[model samples]
Target: MTYEVLARKWRPGNFQDLVGQEHVVRALVNALDSDRIHHAFLFTGTRGVGKTTIARILSKALNCEQGVSSKPCGTCSACTEIDEGRFLDLIEVDAASRTKVDDTRELLDNVQYAPSRGRYKVYLIDEVHMLSGHSFNALLKTLEEPPPHVKFLLATTDPQKLPVTVLSRCLQFSLKRLSREQISGQLKTILESEKIKSDAGSIDAIARAADGSMRDGLSLLDQAISFGAGELLVNDVTDMLGTIDPQGVDNMLDALQDQNADTLMAAVASLVQIGGDYSQIIDALLLRLHEIALAQTDKKLVSDSAGNMDKLLKFADEMPAADVQLYYQIALHGKRDLPLAPDPRTGLEMMALRLLTFQPVAESKPVTNQSVPKTEPAAVSNKQPASTSTSQQPAPAVTASAVTNTASEASPAAAIAPETSKNITQNITMDSPWTDIVNALQISPLVKQLCSNAAMQKDSTFDVSLVLDQSHGQLLNKDRELELKKAMESLWGKTIKLKIELGKPSNDTPAATKKKELDSKQHAAETAINKDENIQALQESFGATIKPGSVRSRV
Candidate 1:
């Protein structure tokens, strides 16, 4: 015997041998067992996903020597010959090569004759979508009305290219690409049966690298076995696939969570030492952030085919849910924009710095005042008696550093008046009561939009009648209504009945009013900035210009 590749050696001989196509198998098997066989069967899917294999197996089932059923006896001449690809009755044609009208006419010329050896004369045309328009026209009549002893089996990777007439004439079975777990499990079974020494992690790496194709997975497994000198090691598999270690991804995430720029650089440095791909490294980090976000919602969502749930859960606990969401968005956007950078390393470094930049300002430690005297602290000296300060006066709030560090800190007293105002606003009786309520309600944007478009009317049976404008009716679905009702109960500390009706609202929605106000303020700010003497001087002297829509009011 000669050496056979894993893909060819492990080719599925029957429907039961196939993996991850139970739906198609069940339909074909039921059809065969009931003897309700269709004349033409079209199997469509991507490369190495058993499109041709299933067509062959169905041909075997149709022409088996023992009987015409789903279960073919492999020992019979018809089945064995068909399996060996030498069966006279099974005419396999590669439409990719023979796609001219003459070849199609020659193929159809034999339709008048019957099967010489088997029960059905099967024409298995692979890549049938490659056939030309003229070729399809030549065979249309024969395909639609073939002889009683003939069967047509068509396979194509791109079914979209096939003509509608041909598509309508056949019963189509679209096979799905296999999952990573399914491919991994099938690889493990083959490796074990071959007496190969391998770990589950190595097989899993190979399976993912295969990208949803079983034959591709087995082919990669063969290459991996050769590369590993007969034993599949996880390290060898990672090197073979050019995949980064999950631990490295975990470390990168930890450094990002701490906002430690040096640690992040060190992580990248280690990967560079090992010749890791920057694109793959960024992709892995994005995947980890996604898993962390999922874990935030449900802790058990932290799972993967590589069994890295522990790392996911660890990062999920270390990072805030808000930070995870923000990082996930940034990393996702960076992946697409990475190519725009001058170099891969530069792109990766910029993304790492961006993660640290967007970190919450509140999380950063407050800078100590070094200029204050040994007797008193700056925070206290600002409020101390002027006599006690004797020599050096405290810096004024108008200082450069104070303006630069505006978002870093605020007096606790600054927020007290707003809290009091909020309490007051909740109590006032006004015509447009929801404007204040919508601002204060801690609901989602959708529910807030739903609330903003609604007007309140008193009813005997309900706490309030909400009249949502007909234009915003789509926002007032059952789930959103329930969320708003729950938020209402939470806000008021009372269970209140509410009725929702769709009609024209009599007043402006809060969102619309807020937008209108912001537009006016923005216009005023733009005007002020443009009219400034210094700005006009810079533009006239240096040809400098301010960006459009960049002016926003502090208010």
Candidate 2:
């Protein structure tokens, strides 16, 4: 008995067994069924994406003993021999090794000759892009007028390297990289047939590590099976792949959501003990954040391969959407700068701390005059009153610090107003100036852009209506409208009804006004530079020219 690796053992023998690349399969099947097969067929894609396998299957279809059809009869002598790689008429060439002109000419020497065993003399060239220029020229001559009794099947990872002359003569089929879900499904099916026990986490880990290649997935599966001593387990697979456990990722995220620095550091300690690349850990975090983001938009878009759908949905609800975006950005930059850090762990810790430190300011509750406690002003005097009936008491001296503290205590509402203004613009109403309001709103740039392009319409009611010019209608959407409404409500400290309509505004929008201001400033600056005494002297004395678009407004 001998052992065969999964990559080879589970290789797709026919088009039906192939995973992904359905577009290529459908086209080839239609061509074969219609008996309209071209003389030359080129398959292109990345490795393990079934380029050569498809070429082999197409060869089987062409030379199958029964007849030319999409579904070849495997029981036939020609099919079996082709499957075993011993068919007489089916010639397999490694274009990489035999790229010389002589080798190519010799390989095609028998192109005009009739097949001794099968109906057609099929040529299967793997990595055909590796052929030399002269070899391509030699092949191109035969391809232009390939004999009716012959067929050419070419496969390559890099089609851009192939000459157009060779390309025009062939029917090209591009194979697509398999998705992680597709690879994971295939792996599960194979494991079931092999009667190997495994868990979802282990299979998912391998699928992600595959990086969209079925062959790579199978290879990792094989390695994982052997490493686990026959049965695949999550712990063993994570150890083999050196990936943090999903629970460990969950713990880190939990610590982040709770703003628990101690718990976050503890999570890092656990990862350090597990021992893997910090960048990879960051990748895992980023992947989970992406899933959470998708879950926020639509739970259905988040795939099961991510594991723990319920937790993802929960995180999506518990975490603010803005915070998700912020964390994702930080993690991306942190991973890029990880190499420059003093140590991997230190870099990861700093990145994690950044996530906690820079979270979006939480929305504040509306405060009323009744809820605010007021304190009476303290009286201070440098001289004692002599009219007291009891013992005369000396007046206590008051310092500047004491006065400041007393003032702060007396007006808690005044203290909170400034902090509230930083997070959410206040005092905005239907009659407020749109330009000033647009500049003051604490919102994302995109939402701000939407608001800036809108002009407020006069109305007698409390509801506010914004008339957006038709030119900027593309920026109007339900999400942006909702965000704008929320921002206005926060600013006004009351519920606001906001309506956005596409039309011509009677007055210039904030954006248009700002643009006009900028243009004026730019023109003024350029005129000032042109009329400057020193600039004119240099221009006349040395023939110095001012570069176009060099002048810019300072304001």
Candidate 3:
């Protein structure tokens, strides 16, 4: 005799044999036991989830020779015929093939008649959603008021396609997909019963590959059994599914944690050489990273530690939370873009490089007592100098002392001096309030570059106009303006106004000119520090960089 496949051979013979669908089973069993059966029943779910099987079992239960009972004795001729799809009273129709209005009319015409040889005449219409609108309309009246001996069982994967009017006429039961553990347990029972030699690890691989479908798992198991001839092995199953071992995934992750590019790429190449699916490898990596993140926050959240939990925990400890989050984001994005790449290997490499580029570096130590060289200001006239032709041009006459005079005058004991001008640029001074405010903002290189070309104008209600040089006017961005305004308010203890206009500078005190000179130099220094590699290294190594407003000097 030809052998029956495991899926059909082990098909659930009774409701008790059904797995992961307790709610549907319980409702149907209770209805059968209490004689509270509905005329029409709808079973909805994905493929391989037992929707049609439940329909068949219900047909047997309703037509059993002993009468409609939940546990029909399989020994009875009526139950046997129903189970074998030979019962004269039971009709199984695939709506996909017979979806015409004429076919539906003919079927319903028979529904009006009483059962010939059983308690009830059952119509099990599978994929009922395929029926055309006209066909559905033709059967609506008969389905709503079918004869007492007729039962309608409709099954469909896509229930949303079914009309609401039709759905309202029947009792619907949605079947759920089985979980990995549930599938694994069921596979173990089947293998043991069949006396097939297999390992739990091999069964797990099949279960995961099945993705919550029992039929899929059994079909996969059948392939593995045939491939192995007599026994199923983990290695054989892994190769059959084109999936990498969990250990290979863990190894790849370890390489990532260590930032060992060579090792990671080698592991990927090894999987490719063995004909493993690169996409699945990436999926497994993502899942493992999630486990690592969980292990970081709570050790107990780590699942199936076995021997790899230690490595995962170590990775969690060594990496910062922000870095981990960044890695996860990069990996997800890479997965999305992987298909567009020429090859999976190249895609995986690009993803690894992205993570490496963003990893945080160790902080550096701070440099102290660094001094900047000072220059003497050339004499100036009341008229604008040639140097002032460009707004960003330096004022040869003004000195650093002139710019900081107000700040020093306001608080004599404030330690305000030329040496501390860098910090003073971050604050406003009482001396020449308007000029000093601009000088203080010059502490920021970006602001100084933009404002150097700005000549102070008369203050309006909310708008203080500055004569802007065309070249430098474009330098001011929204962020820089906001920062300047915030610093000015901190100095004045109230809101100061601002407006930009085109004009020339007013001949004021040489002190004001001197203040502008000092402000320019301080601003230049700040810009240099921002682009300085040495400063960045110091910041990363020792974490000792000055705050935005804090003073730093060359000693």
| TM-score, prediction 1 | 0.63
Model 2 CA RMSD to the hidden true structure, in angstroms? 23.7
Separately for all candidates shown, the number of backbone clashes (residues 3 or more apart, or on different chains) is: 0, 0, 22
Q: What digit string (tens of lDDT, one per residue) describes model 1 on residues 302-332?
A: 4346546666677765566656766776677
Q: In model 2, where do residues sit more than 4 Å from their true spots?
A: 362-555
Q: Cα RMSD to native, each candidate?
A: 23.6, 23.7, 22.8
Model 3 lDDT, full chain set: 0.70
Candidate 1: clashing pairs of residues: none
**Per-candidate TM vs. native?**
0.63, 0.65, 0.60
lDDT of 3 at 514: 51
Model 2 residue 321 CA deviation (Å) reads: 1.4
Deviating ranges (above 4 Å) for candidate 3: 291-324, 339-343, 355-555
Better of 1 and 2 by lDDT: 2
Q: Which one wins by TM-score: 1 or 3?
A: 1
Q: Which has the higher TM-score value, candidate number 1 or candidate number 2?
A: 2
lDDT of 3 at 4: 90
Poorest 10 consecutive residues by lDDT, candidate 2: 363-372
Give the per-residue lDDT of model 3 (tens digit) for 1-555.
897999988888778788788899999999999999999999999888889888888988998888778887777998888777799998888999998889988888888778888899999999999999998887678777778888999999999999998999999999999877778888889999999999766887898889878899999999999998879887788888888776677766666555444576676777677777667767767776787778767887764422245677787765555556656766786687788767887777656545443443321101000111133332233355667667524553244544344333323222222223444554345345554555555245455545555666566455455666655556667787777777667766678676655455564322346556546654654564455343454346434433332222111
Highest-lDDT candidate: 2
Per-residue lDDT of 388-460 in model 2, one digit per residue for the tens? 5133332222244444543442342232122223432455555778876765666555566677778988765
